[model samples]
Target: MRSDGTLSLERRRQEREEAKLLVLRKRGSRLAFEWGLQQCVKSVNATPRLLVYLLREVCVLAGRLARGGRV
Candidate 1:
């Protein structure tokens, strides 16, 4: 049978391990959140380019209309 001191030490060790696992889980969740945020930022960055392309098309169509050409 283990002595009281030995039992206390074992309990402390288990608690430390549990604490470490919790820390690791928190870090993993934080990393996932950061990655998702980065993907959102990238998608947002593409919006201006799409708007520019659509604007150019509209301008070209307007020019054709002014020249008496069919759309």
Candidate 2:
């Protein structure tokens, strides 16, 4: 959350990523989210593939925008 009572997109991403990674850390035997792990075999309780892809893409798109690159 920001002073204006809303989260910046980047901030929101970080928070969400933290939540996602925490689940992995506590349950998937992972310390952090990894791109390579996205498509790996895992228990059904692990994070969904679509979430991993979307979160990664969101961050990539955000980086591109930050660098003034076209989407």
Candidate 3:
């Protein structure tokens, strides 16, 4: 018996291939989700460092502008 109720070796092979594809798809999605979560955690932990660097750069630029009398 096949998906369409017809017995054939081709159909069985197709079904096997489809099943393998589905499993691979599920595994890929799981890995992608976990990788995204890890990236999120890394970015979250670096948030404060990013903010501090941004502010420091901003202050430096502001000082340079003031020195040029372009406040």
Candidate 4:
């Protein structure tokens, strides 16, 4: 009976450790997902501004070419 009790206690301890590890893994995955989502949002927000800058540069180059300014 004493040996059985000892085994039960050890089993409970192992289960608790497994639960803790599972929680930690879940939290890590959630944090990683959030970080990736934030990076995507930042890139999406910046894209339009980058496109506008490129468009302005292209317009300038075209104007220079039209003017035959040795572009």
Q: For this target, which candidate reaches the highest lDDT against the unseen true structure?
A: 2
Report the C-alpha lDDT of model 1 over 1-71, residue by residue, as the tens digit: 26653556545654554454446447764443344344346655423333453455567768889999976
TM-score of each: 0.35, 0.39, 0.32, 0.35
Highest-TM-score candidate: 2
Model 2, CA-based lDDT? 0.57
Pick by TM-score: 2 or 3, better one: 2
> In candidate 1, residue 32 scores what lDDT?
35
Worst-scoring 10-residue span by lDDT in model 4: 45-54
lDDT of each candidate versus the true structure? 0.51, 0.57, 0.51, 0.50
Residue 23 deviation, candidate 3, in Å?
Answer: 38
Name the regions of candidate 2 deviating beyond 4 angstroms.
Answer: 1-3, 31-71
Candidate 3's TM-score reads 0.32
Candidate 1 residue runs with Cα over 4 Å from true position: 1-46
Q: 17 in model 3: Cα distance from truth in Å?
A: 40
Worst 10 residues of 3 by lDDT: 45-54
The root-mean-square deviation over C-alpha atoms between each candidate and the true structure, in angstroms, is 21.7, 13.3, 19.5, 20.9
User: Which regions in candidate 3 have their CA more than 4 angstroms from the true location?
Assistant: 1-46, 69-71
Candidate 4 ranges with C-alpha deviation above 4 Å:
1-46
Write the candidate numbers in order of decreasing TM-score. Answer: 2, 1, 4, 3
